[model samples]
Target: MNLKFTPLACLLAPLLTACGAGESDETPIAIPAYTLTVNLPQTGTLCVDSNQNDSCDAGELEVSGPAGARQLQSQAPGLLTSPLLFIPGDPAALILMHPAARQDGQHLTPSLLSSLLQSRIAEGTPPHQALSELLAALAPLQPNQELASLHRLQEFNLALGELIMAVLTQNGAVPAPPAASSQTRVWPGLFILLPELSRHFANGGDLLDLQARLEAILLQQQPRALVTASGVSTYSDGTDYLLTDEPADHPGQDASLKQQPLRYRKLDSQGQPLPDNASQWDCVEDLNTGLIWEKKLDDASSPRDLHRVFAWEFGPYRPTQDELDYACPNSEAICTTQQYRQWLNQQQLCGIGHWRLPHAQELMSLQHYGSLHQQGGQTATLDVRYFPDLGAGANGFDGYYWSQTLTPSRRLESVPLAVITPIFWGSDAGTDYPTAVQTPSDVNALQLRLVGEVTR
Candidate 1:
């Protein structure tokens, strides 16, 4: 392998006594520094580890984007620690590494996982070549070795996730490192239970039986099943689990990353901060996005009650009598989404006057896709802790939340559509994936969640 070590210039002339070279025949040899170019997936951070802590420190050479050059100061083979780590934009993205095998002009890609490839290099195969062989070897393993291959793959992913936790923690990110006890339960659960799953499958184990066992381990482990991607915190309900979109590193050339969970701060009616554990709050501020969201109330007397649904008054069609009855059950004057926004602004709900319907993307950001899994008959798509007032609609699923965006299709001008996202699913009902849907702006009785810009 070609090594790209750059030569260091001599500090002083050997003939000059002032340089301290005349007193000794020996001269200090400078350690060679290697540079590598990292190509990220449109977004992510790259850190060249100088301290070997595996995290990007304040003064470390760090870059972010699709591509950048980082200088690796340590030339030592990365037997134990990664010399370079590329953290992708997604919080759950598998941390890719420039394996320990130092090579010149090594074009490092995001698909490289340090541990497995490094292990191969320890056996004397070059990493680039080893990567190729490993990819080829991963293709459809023999029946006898299938279980073993799976176990190995899981181990590598877990090890890589541990490294990611270290990086996140060192950077003061939210995810805490998994405790040693968690690691203990996680590994043995995988090793012991996987074979059982395979055998059970071989013996005609039903899908529900396998699911129950897998769910049990996921629950019994509490957190860090070692299979769940890092960065996302465990939900109060163990049924909510986020499966990483990360492809097997050995076979896939590129994969999407799991993003860090969005941080939120609760606010009271006066726009004052509340403790995260606070049982009551009128609004939630997305710390990552700097957007504040309105919290629906449980009381029907309040205009912001979760049960009240409204039609978009600004649409081409007017609300039908049934729509008005559902939105303003007690014949409240404000029966439409526009009227609700006006009332909220007039009252300056949560001490913010600019509250308006959120864009579709902004509203969808609150959705927790992991909640799609069927568990305990709970089917809300958002974290109930932060957004406690989302209620089942007349149709029995979590009600739809209206967005300001209109649909792009060229339907009849009189039937213009507005975007809405389903916030809940009925047990044994609803689509497999929760996403935004377009409905008749004036006819659909959708709920509204307002968002506002941060006031600095």
Candidate 2:
């Protein structure tokens, strides 16, 4: 969508100025004649307030960005996104500063941030990269500040510059560092920046949406696999390995589903597990989804010490009151959704480059929960026999998992406020954890977890 701005309103304030004292002439002023152009952020209806009345009057002036008249309306709303595509963050971050950053006597101002951005831009840094550095600079100072509200780039940059300057000029008022606590807060800049980051991921700009579109074109006729076929004959959960008994070509899968034993080993396409000496971390293949997952237990505590544990985190949004006390599940390790993908790529899990965080629908597809003994009630929503260790350990966040979907609160649109989390557990009536009709992301659930995948 393109918005072309034209300053053509032909009116002035009710009060006027006398042009000549003797003539007692009163001349009405006209709005300035200027031209401005802006690009629409997405495919949406455009309305311009032609009369400056702050309302979209009938046949009002153009409200879209500089693109004159071109606009894109998506029949499929899920495909909405910014700048046309989604990519993991590059070197850019958002830095917003407070309108009044300094005290009565301080000299630091929002302009410093502007200067930093200007210099970075002059040096050829992309706006995004410049933003990343600006936010990074602000992160170290008051890194543990609590997030007070949602943020935007413009104001955030102002506050970021303000915080850095204030920290640098500190007169020994910094608090004593607390005794060791994993609960220490995260960087304020990051806390504030995540929501904006999440917005960039909305409207089909993300990998999930990209894959969905691609999958439609490539596998339209094929059924989507939600329930996995273990191929382990010992456990016949009655899951149909085949939608039908007729021979089928595995268009989505390179390997056919062949029955194996419960003691199945992680394998590459050639069917081999990680070398025997270092088999602690392993993968699993979902014959149903043709996607490989990294077992939740396969991460940290590895003898090899892969840096699997990340800081507890949230994407771009503030939490509600009921969500405030919730911490990342003890069952989970603090890892971001992005790292989950990077690891898959690094390990070349199942030898596939496209291993990614699952979409909400894709993640929920795994939840075919029933009260069968093997399922172990609401506590273990997945097949515990095959994935027996999932909810067992001291820190397992058994019935919850992350999805690569960003959603807005039910009431607001401009605020792309929440990441979708899927509940793998059962009713609260039967369990300790509160049950909800909808599963929203737990802001503190950054380490929520990664399910296992194969060698691809």
Candidate 3:
């Protein structure tokens, strides 16, 4: 998706020579030529108005579908550059654009198109000035301000584009755009749910009215665990998560899902809950499940270091000698899962004395499948905001945390518990995103995240 840009200064130059009032000039005015080369992820048709006419005539140059750079020339005389119309088949139906960026050979994505439209430009504005305004408008939309992956952002653009295209082609009318919300992170939700909502109402409702109705519906509903949404809003067979209400009204909620994204509350070292927006915390409470989870630290010397690994066994389980050596080094505390649970209880983590290893299903509850879709693959499967330092650790451990659910060992007489591992490397699209399998009880290379029942 490379887009080659030329100096907009020359394109913005006046197309006519100054002449005296009432002076008749018969000379034909020469139109300045402008070249644009667009690189696409896949072969797509591109059209630019090569003539002063507002339409792409048959005689005008059009680039054929090819998954690479496609160049076109435009000589339209105007302050506003002709819209670069593209038809990228499938996922991307139609991408309308103008020279809203000044970079040379930059990859073109729906995100780029989104930023351009965010400028809310007035008609007849010069290309260079529009580019400047676009950048300024895009400053607050960065990932830090509005959490979104590149893939999700592109998906959003495509979804919105197709919806608009369908309305114009099928309904023969263009609905007015919805008013922008004060929240900067609403685009993902808008992109994921707005289309379906429009279709749900037969595409006749005003976008603003629909948005208000949907918001009211969401406000009245509570977050349900089984009905929890993964934030995926597209291509679900008869089951769309976006339409469901999962209690997403709280501030600082993770922007990962469109419906009811995961909600978590942080806790201080003394087991006291902290503010929702607190940047530092020692524990996390899943608002939906009412379970508090241990927060691992990045420091190697800390007992809760994310890199720490342990061995497990059933019926009077104990840590392996290597684990004891690494974990308890020069300390009198025993270094086993049972001992760790007892230690946390003694400390009353989050003011709870029942800290224990989570069951397989409880651990699975933390898995967010939308991560695979939003991030594509080979990324952390949990919300880093609540569970940072997840995924692979030192020496390439698969981040399989030991769970309490036991499975009979085939060869060994002792039963080994199942360990759940979130695929951090890659995914078969998401079919195998949740990897839970039985492992040898004596295996000394596994991680652990303790969880406790929410009694308070």
Candidate 4:
């Protein structure tokens, strides 16, 4: 919602922009006229959309974190140097450059934090359970007590996270704890530190040292599923499938958003009444969004081919040992991600094989929270009639599905590219809904459901 700009030399973050023209001829050296944009997870578009079209249009960058999407763009700034845009007033800006950029990894903005936090809450994920998952994501940076200074700062920042979440809760509606647990718990210093942290994050501080500290301490909250802005791209296995997250606009107040609808259809045409027999393999269509989904998952009884998964570098690089072996027999001329597109153009399943992966938001739309016991309803984890058998863990055919959408951050050769994977169930419980993760790209562990747009 706010904007600031600095030289690219300081913070080498990603760029997202739209510009009219450059400086007049009087200027000898062309300086980048920076336009910094922050995508408010408050809307889920990750700030990439210059027009707020509910989609990432050209020139808009997607950022992750509880801070929403933060983007810096220039019309003529050459590749050599780009300015770093910071919303001093937005706490999410601190993380966008901090731990993720500091560790030379990825940073989840504050908007993303709210999305993860609120999504879990809305879907009935226990607060502690959701918090634990985020903490686990941060566990990789484990230093819970190593630095007294960092410990103190993290606690202060975490309280700020709570404060921001309160403000983000749909129309600022903070839920009261159940009567049974409300009396036993206490939120210490939560009120006292809110104003201080909010001010510190907003001002972005003049003390360079303070900026560094702000970045470091936020690691304490250590959230996961931190959303990121990604551009459109399709993946090709044997076939090209467009990928995206679940895109159904939820009606209730969620932390990641104020009042944006999924902007897409919630149910497919055939979803209302599943076939009584097992023969309904026809892809179903969501009239509103034009996205068609596979009726069922790949057969669990059949052996899986993990090598089928590939990163931009190509060749299912991160598969399980079993998958690695399976990928070995006569495997040459391995199809890189680029080559996969050619495959997709040729793929035609259900009389429509040119499928693509869905974005994280687009794909997430499939979850039927009503199916979860926590949601107090029973409709099946998803539109069971449409997406029957979206399994979980190492067992069933259902599990994490692949999305072709790429992150706003660059790939670090030292480590795999971080990406969001869609999951349907957590434990063995039949009632669990779905959730997502911002983890390294891996495929041997899960399968994918194909989705695409069909025109009559």
- Considering every candidate listed, which one attains the maximal TM-score? 1
Residue pairs of candidate 3 with colliding backbone atoms: 1-107, 1-108, 3-106, 43-66, 43-67, 271-350
lDDT of 4 by residue, 203-266 (tens): 5532222433433333222111212212112222323233222223432223223322222232
lDDT by residue (201-300, candidate 2, tens digit) is: 3332332323233323323211333434422222221454434332343333212345221223444443345543343434554456544555554445
Q: Pick the candidate with the highest lDDT.
A: 1
> Residue 227 in model 4: shift from native, Å?
14
Q: Which of 1 and 2 is ahead in lDDT? A: 1
lDDT of each: 0.52, 0.36, 0.49, 0.37
Model 2 steric clash total: 48
Q: Kindly give the stretch of ten consecutive residues in candidate 3 with the minimal lDDT sum.
A: 178-187
Instruction: Estimate, for each residue in 136-249, the C-alpha lDDT of model 1 and write its tens digit.
Output: 444432232321232234433444355334433545567543332323323323433444544544454532354445545544322322122222333332332343343243
lDDT of 3 at 165: 43
Count of clashes, each model: 11, 48, 6, 59
RMSD of each: 25.0, 20.1, 23.5, 24.2
Model 4's TM-score against the true structure: 0.33
Off by over 4 Å in 4: 1-279, 297-347, 373-380, 392-398, 407-414, 428-443
